[model samples]
Target: MTLLPDPIISTWLFSSVVFGPWSNHVTGWWEKKQTHSKLLYLFYEDMVEVNQITTSCAIKMLLELEYSIQVRGRVQFENMKKNSFVNYFTSLAMDFKISPFMRKGKVGDWKNHFTVAQSEQFDEDYKKKMKNITVQFHTVV
Candidate 1:
């Protein structure tokens, strides 16, 4: 992974590619979720369509952000996708055309891109780094 200057999606998916280990970000919120009512800890795979709607509504309500029906329906997700401020795909740092920001967001999609060696390396690294992390995440749904 060090041979390449920029990490591919595989390494980024594993964690700590660009910034600090993603585990650090997640672990920071670990104990907070237990004490905080507003903290919505979630796994993408566990969120079905209904859960997604409820979660989105809960987030908006918690943040006290109001959105009109028409405004919400009009912009949709495309609004964020097009807005350079919110979309890193528009950034010059890395080319999104190569990996694409919104790839198929299905469970176990990592298997499609990762090889056996890469998977082994990631697993070993995960064990070492996540030794104290209490969050339980599964790669496949």
Candidate 2:
């Protein structure tokens, strides 16, 4: 499993790649879900549907700030989720570009870019790599 980033930044960073049959990195986290609720599980296609990356990042940033070690014991999750990011980035809006962060957050996106055999190869590898793990694989979309 990959090591999680600093908790402060982790809250603001949403993953755009977490799907079935080919996501050991993602599954590892699922196995430890209770340990890391700050990890926003997002697919590539979701980004395309939303069309806003900065807003997503800002929300994450705010979430992290409110849910870190200093506040988790005192704040209720419902209250934190209710806050919006509409005014969070006004001071730094032009400092960052959104295109690089926006991508085709879609499931099966590989189908359009990978050959049938290549896809099968990935599945084979996935099965082999996950042989000892007990988690069941399921398609999300």
Candidate 3:
């Protein structure tokens, strides 16, 4: 029911064609992980736990990585924002000043942007598209 173009739930379905859509890209890799022994695809929430307000493996990785100056230098966001070398593709895709790359970063923040009608509609579409997805991602919002 939410008509807003950027609502988080629907974005997975209708994001720009340049990258296909998030759902397809994610489930593709999720499905791919079945066949590829070395492929590792983790949800963003799994990577940035503090920022995500959800489960994250990053805190442990960060602590383990503290001794490595090389790893620490590239992982910080402010540094990445300013480092054209790391943000080349992001710069081409988005102007962070106009619409920040990271907003609240909350799990259910999409509900804030959706009207009741929009929410209902999104719920319906989401159900249909995702019914076949067996891999489940859970987050407490």
Highest-scoring model, TM-score: 1
* Cα lDDT tens digits for candidate 3, 28-139: 8778879985565555455455543322234344346444555445555565566666534453556656755454445666666677776686567667767887777645
Candidate 3: where are CA atoms >4 Å away? 1-20, 44-93
Tell me which residue pairs clash in candidate 3.
1-117, 1-118, 1-121, 1-122, 2-118, 2-119
What tens-digit string does per-residue lDDT give for candidate 2 at 34-58?
4776655544344334425633453
List the candidates ranked by TM-score, beginning with the highest.
Answer: 1, 3, 2
Candidate 1 vs 3: which has more lDDT: 1
Candidate 3 TM-score versus the reference: 0.53
TM-score of each candidate?
A: 0.58, 0.35, 0.53
TM-score, prediction 1:
0.58
Worst 10 residues of 1 by lDDT: 1-10
Please, what is the whole-model Cα lDDT of each candidate in the order they appear?
A: 0.61, 0.45, 0.57
The residue ranges of model 1 lying beyond 4 angstroms of the native Cα positions read 1-16, 31-36, 49-91
The weakest ten consecutive residues by lDDT in model 2 span 8-17
Model 2 steric clash pairs: 44-105, 44-106, 45-105, 45-106
2 against 3, candidate with superior TM-score: 3
In the range 32-79, model 1's lDDT, one tens digit per residue, is: 887897787766565433444655665575544454344344334455
